[model samples]
Each structure stands twice: as structure tokens, then as C-alpha cells.
Target chain A: MTSNASGRKNLTFISRRSPYGSGYAKACLDMVLSAAVFDQHVTLVFMDDGVLQLQPNQQAGDIHAKDLSAALAALPLYDVDNVYADRDSLTRRGMFSDQLAIEVRLCDADKIAEIIRQSDVVFTL
Target chain B: MTTLHTVNKHSLNSDLLTSCLRVARGGDCILLIEDGIYNVRTLEDLAARQGCELSGLQCCVLHDDLTARGLAEKDLPDFISAVDQAGFVALACAHRQSVHWF
Candidate 1:
């Protein structure tokens, strides 16, 4: 279903902020998921402290809400694959993909540039 | 061939400015929306020094946001254009895609 111009839109959602403290993260994730439901190709790139959202066993029990980590894990079932994490950001935070519950492709700085270039639409939160 | 980059946050920690600089192409335009209007001066200086071709790429600030923040056009770089919500929508439609940086 890939067309050069109009078949499907390529959307990249970049999350560089914390997931729990604010509504921005949740809103962004919701938007991306909705876009995916419409059959758009979606890519999620987590940078900086955004990687915290992917940490295994996130217990938001204290927050009195559905776990965000659980929602993020359901992305693949919705056909919203291509999750990525910036290598520098992960290393800077002393984390690795294995430490996360969701599988994420490690991307270097150059790859980050490529992601932006390839995306038809990008949202940063 | 037009591409619109929408910057919506004010903090340097947001890294939106860096992202804007990274993906900005020759003919693409940058729009400072929401809290992003504050970046016009810094971006203009960088654009000039980097010799980045911005004449073909319009730089705009949302007038509504500026007013709400108690900022004026004179406070921004002279090259930056100010637009309203209708103009913002027109800009997004004119561009092939829009990138939001927060």
C-alpha cells in the first residue's frame, strides 16, 4: 500500500520529555496511535530522558492511572512498529535496549538525521 | 516543495531548535508557534553565520502567541514574519509536510 505521493503518510513522533509528569507525552502517543489506525506508517523515536518511559516494570500505581508503559507496549499490535531510541541518549543515561520492555532500534546521531529526512510528518513532545 | 517546521516550546532543554537546524532544507520554512516565537533572534543569528539560505525559506512567528506573551514584533529579528491562525493553517497546507518541535 506504499505510494510515492499519496498511498500512506510517513509519521515520526519524537518523545524527548518525561512520560509521567505531564500530559504532553500521553497526548503525543495518542495522536500517533490514532494516525496508525488510519493506516499511516508511524515511527516513534525516543530521545534524552524520554527513554525512561520504556523502562521495564514501570509502576505508575502512585499516580492512579493506567500504566503508560503498558500502553506503549501495545503499539506493535496496532501495526505501529519502527520504534527507535537515540544511542547517544541511551548511553548518556546509562541504559540499553535490553533494559527496556519494548524493542527499540538503536540510532546514532546520523541516523536521527536520516529519520527526520525520511519522515513526511514529525511531532516532538 | 515547501516544508513547514513548527516550533512550539520555549525552553532550550527542549532541543527543538537543534532539531529544526538539523532537518531544515534550502527551501523549507520555519514557523515559531506557541512558545517557539522567542527563538527568532537566536535562529536568525545562527542562520546568518551559517550562511544558511533562509530567503527562500520564510521564518514566521505566531502573532497571537507573541501578544499573549506580551512580546512585540520589534523584539524579534527583523526578518521574521508574524502570522495569525488562518495563516498558520494556510502554511501547513502549502507545505508538503509539517514537523512539530516542542
Candidate 2:
């Protein structure tokens, strides 16, 4: 068994689902954020419907809850700055870079596959 | 590389199983936890008839979950291995990456 003594581990969180509708997305985000708090190098990739999460100007008021948009705003402060988005997904959804609050790297399908192949750990929500 | 899948939903509609199967590579393993255990037979059958090679792939179920669901090892297909928490960690360590399917 190889020891994880290298100290630096690449952890990627794949959020394929939307945010806030189910506990899955929120829980996954919380865990990744917690891992980042411990100084782990965390990468959060939003794909498919998960891209809806990074949409700007969202209000959860109708659902009677605090807006999750605020949580994403703090990601950089936690040093989890590697936030990515699927380029095809955005195009299919008719969304543009101006629609997002966070600056995301728009990757194609092939790039998304490459990212998953290289990650030390991937959590899908 | 081995991939550990943490499945929490039992419904067939859950894309957890399909997504995992699609990305699984040779020498990789899959563990069915929570409600994910139910997909063992489904996956095996698909692999057999559809020519989908789960090459060097092993399926595992969480023993605690099976017990809680009143299911026994014998109740599951022969392809599934009942594992404990330690086994879960061992599988995770064996795999290059881990994905949680909820």
C-alpha cells in the first residue's frame, strides 16, 4: 500500500445535480468545504444540471431558506479556488460566462473526462 | 484503478449505478452501500447479456446495510461481496479515486 505521505492530495467533487433541491448537493458541497478547511486541495466541477448552482442572482426566498449563492462566494476564501464548469453544458443551457458569479474554466467533454481520470478522489452528487 | 461508489438511494431511477458503470475501467471495483446494494443483480445481468465486460471488477455490499434491510448474504446474487466498514476503507485505499452516488 502506498502511504499518502506526499501530503498533497487532489480531491475533486463532481456535482452533477442541482443545488438546494435535495440534500445531496448541499451535503457534498459541505463536505468538500470542510475538507478545504483542513487545507486539502479541493476542486469542484459543476456539470450537467449541477451548472445551475453557479448561476448568478438566485434567491431561495420562495423556499423559505437562506440563499446558497452566499456559500459559493466563500469558496475562494477557503482556498478551494479550482471551480470548473462544463462548456457544453453551459452552451446547451443557453448560458454565458456573464451569467455566473464565479469565474469558471469552461471545459469541453474531453477535458471533463481528463479531469476525472487525473483526480485522486472524486465525489459525485 | 479501483473506484468506490457510495450509493444511498434505492430507487431504480437513481442514475448512480448507470453513471458508475459508464466510467468504470478494468482492474476497478465497485461497492454497493446503503440502498445501492439492490443494483448488484441488475448490473451483473446487464454485463452478461449486453457484452458489457466488468473486467476484473468486483461488487461489494455493506454488511450493516444488508442486515438493517433484513437481507442476508445468501439473499444476494453470487457476484456481490458483503463487506464491513474496514473493508470499505480498504477498497477506497485500493482505488485511485472514490465517487459518492446519492
lDDT of 2 by residue, A5-91 (tens): 767667788888777778766776798899898767788888767888888887888788666767878888888878888776677
TM-score of each: 0.72, 0.67
Model 2 misplacement above 4 A = A1-6, A22-39, A47-49, A62-64, A70-79, A86-101, A106-125, B44-53, B63-89
- DockQ for all models: 0.35, 0.33
Residue ranges of candidate 1 with Cα displaced over 4 Å: A1-7, A108-113, B44-57, B67-75, B84-87
Instruction: Quote model 1's TM-score.
Output: 0.72
lDDT tens digits by residue: candidate 1, A1-125: 12256668778898877778888778878988999899898889888778778878877887786688889988999888788888777787788777886888898655765676677777878
lDDT of 2 by residue, B1-102 (tens): 455666665537665665556556556677778787667657776566545467567778899987788788888887678999999989888777777766
Give the winner by DockQ: 1
Residue B66 displacement (Å), model 2: 4.7
DockQ (C-alpha) of model 1? 0.35
Interface RMS for model 2: 2.7
**How far out, in Å, is residue A99 in model 1?**
3.0
